[model samples]
Target chain A: MGPLVPQEIIGADWNLFIAFAIGIGFGFVLEQAGFSSSRKLAGMFYGYDTVVLKVFFTGAITAMLGLLFFSLFGWIDLNLIYVNPTFLGSAIVGGVIMGAGFIIGGFCPGTSVCAAAIGKIDAMIFIGGIFLGIFFFAEGYPLLKDFYMSGSMGPLKVSDVFGISGGVLALIVIITAIVMFKLGELAEKRWPREEY
Target chain B: MKTKYMNPYLAGVLLGLVLLMAFFFSGRGLGASGAVKSVVVAAVDVVAPEHTANSGYYSKYVGEGKSPMKAWLVFEMIGVLVGGFLSGAFSGRLKWKVEHFPGITANRRLIFAGMGGILFGFGSQLGRGCTSGSALTGMASLSVAGFVSMMVIFGTAFALAFFLRKNWI
Candidate 1:
């Protein structure tokens, strides 16, 4: 019923416009959430701010639940949405690398863009580094193709892997998020950092 | 005076709604790295068309009437820039400065920032997405890849936080 562009309800010509609109909301929310500040984003791991933890999990669950309801209401076709395909080796290794980057760099690609928009010099350099990093990856693609293309699992959902319904997995994740939120609040109290 | 940041939960909900809108209208979630990838692919194609044509990786995205720069993600990213600027302007947060800990030199912070960006950019390609494209969007769809990426990325950061304390704390 939805996914208007894919379903032909919305013309293909409007795709870029729609994408721009969505990005606006996304960037606005991120900036408003203080994701523009690398120091604030990095605070999650330090037991000081914990805003990242709170915001990330809450945002994730909100979307998850929203999708479920949309499907239930027949407003959208859950089957039509894109789910990221899994490549176990790259996923794990890449995640580890990104983890190190997050701690060291303070901002992820999206957040860095937002930070740069507000004229953060560090963020601008970070973006230049991103460009160079991607360039290096492209140059080395011939050597990395084997591993990059390995362990492909086609768009498998967590519910499918666990042999549970999507609803059940959503429930469990919600519970987990609540637990994490509590821990986040506690962490904030235990180690308060002055607001920047 | 700078306005206080929005409540995290409220911001999260707003972010979630935006993500939902993306899925509802376009049938995909939010992404950041993919747009960067598109730009990279485009740049490479322009610099060395034959190299890209011969390369296994770049070939997948370029050629055959496909214009990488016109990608949906690219337009979305441009919007993100505008939106971020608008929000920053409204909140009185727009300023030309380097954000860093008082203990560290700005140059040191810039160097780490660049290094971190490089690693993240490389890793995002290898992982097929960064935080927004993989972890957050993946989790929203309940994909195992999403959960795994989320756990590992956050886990590694937490594990290494102590070592990087001098940079932030």
Candidate 2:
């Protein structure tokens, strides 16, 4: 009954409007969580501030549980939702490159956009770099095509792999999040930093 | 009047609800990089139509009666910019400044920021998503790609943190 757009419950005309509305909430929450601060985001790795860890895992667990409950309640069809396809080779290698970018740039694409919106000068330049990088990737697409298309696992689920229910996995994730939050708290105290 | 951030858990819950709403209404999770990609595709299409028409990667997104700029992610990204600005205004955090480590020069920070963006943009394309699109949304759908991306991205960052200590700490 839900996933209204795909189910035809919500008209196609409203799709873009809904996307914008959802994005507003997404951006508002992110900024409120202090995601607009690159230094604060980078603080997670340094043990000075663990806000990123606390916020990120908590958000993921919340959505995972929400989806599970929605499915259980028949509010949404889990089958209808989009599942990201897995390409192991690219996933791992690409993540490594993104990780390097995260440490070096201090902001991911989403966070960088938000930071730029708030008038962070470095974020603006970072966005320019993103455009250039994408341009290069497109121009060189012929060469990287094979590696990019390799190892297509086709939307594999962790639950399917573990032979467990989504709920069970979500419960484990919740427990893991709690433990991580504890570590995060400890780290914040162990290495407090004056405001940057 | 600079206000403090909301509690992390509370903000996270709100973010989660937004994500849930996305799935409930659209059958897809939130994304950030895809919007950027759409822009890139649109730009390439305008600059060199024949090149985009011939290129395998760019061809998928461009064609007759279709405008990549009119995509859902693009609208969402515009909203992100507006929402971010509104929040920043409300919290008095809106300022034109370069934020960086006290130890690093602002110019050096900008240079790194640009380099980092380049790498992230390229990587997101290869990986099929960035933090929001791949890691968060994928995990929400219980996909292996989501978990793996989350782990590897964070792991690599942690591993490289030592070498980049001068930049952040």
Candidate 3:
């Protein structure tokens, strides 16, 4: 019942307001964590900073745990939340393409938005590229329509695939993140960056 | 100006709390590219109403009295811009400049940045979401798409990092 808008617990007008407030929190946290810098973002791959991995996994796990606890405590209904449907082909292929894009552009869409807001010219160009690329996709939809809709897996969860409960899976993730953070700390020490 | 950024772990915690709050209130996760898609569809519709109406793809978003600008992600992203600007201003990082590896020319960097953006934009459509939507938010909901997309995106980047060393390293 806690999905206030969907459950009619909150008015429709509050939807956009909540979105705005959440976005502010998201953007603030992203920028305050130094996500505006490309070098710092790419550091996850290079082991120079590794803040990306640490922050990323930590955020994911924190939310995962929070949601689980909320569900348990009757604060929110888990079934109301939207889960991304799994498309085997598009998920891998699209992600691969985006990954290549990440290294080349030095920013993901979200981080790019944050960077662009901070007056980053490269990020602005990246934003332009996003529109151009999307336009190309939209125009070429006829040719790629079949491929895009090829995979049709329902909203599957990793926990179910692993035959474990969300709490258990989250626990493992927390433990793994702890180990990764230690390694990340070592990596940052081993390969320090002059900037960011 | 405060140059000190929040500790990464703390920032992560804050970000997580935001995501959780989003789920609690919206029954959905955060997104970035979906808003761009709305803008793109609306732009096309405005520029060529006939074409947008004719196309199966663009027609879904346009021609239905549905203003793409009136989307959740769109409003949230406006807030993102404002919040980002505020953070940058407070930190004294709000200067207009191009950032790149020292080894690469500015032109090369910009060109690659565009190319990457192009690929990501298209790929996000193909994948049905961007890192924030499909990966981060998906993970929060424990969806398989989240894990798969997150792995593939980061894994591919790791695999290609050596080849693109001049760009980042």
TM-score of chain A of each: 0.98, 0.98, 0.96
Provide DockQ values for all models, in the order shown. 0.84, 0.83, 0.83
Q: Write down the RMSD of all candidates, one decimal each.
A: 1.4, 1.5, 1.7
Positional deviation of residue B151's Cα in model 2 after best superposition, in angstroms: 0.5
Could you tell me which 10 consecutive residues in candidate 2 chain B have the lowest summed lDDT? Answer: B1-10
Off by over 4 Å in 2: B1-3
For model 3, chain A alone compared with the true chain A gives a TM-score of 0.96
The residue-by-residue lDDT of candidate 2 on A1-196, one tens digit each, is 8899999999989999999999888888888889998899999899998888988888888899999998999999999999999999999999999898899899999888888889999988888878887887888889998999999999899999999999899989889889999998889889977664
Assign candidate 2 its CAPRI class: high
Indicate the residue-level lDDT of A144 in model 2: 96
Candidate 1, residue B35: Cα displacement in angstroms equals 0.8
For A1-196, candidate 3 gives per-residue lDDT tens digits of 6888889899988999999999998898899999998888998888987888978998999899989999999989988899999989989999999999998899999999999999999999999999988999999999988998897889999899999999988888889889989999898889867666
- Local accuracy by lDDT, each model: 0.91, 0.90, 0.90
Share of reference contacts found in each model: 0.83, 0.82, 0.83
| lDDT per residue (tens digit) for residues B1-169 in model 1 | 1328989989988998999899999999999988999999998899899988999889988889989999889999999999999999999999999999999999999999999999989999898899999999999999889999999999999999999999998
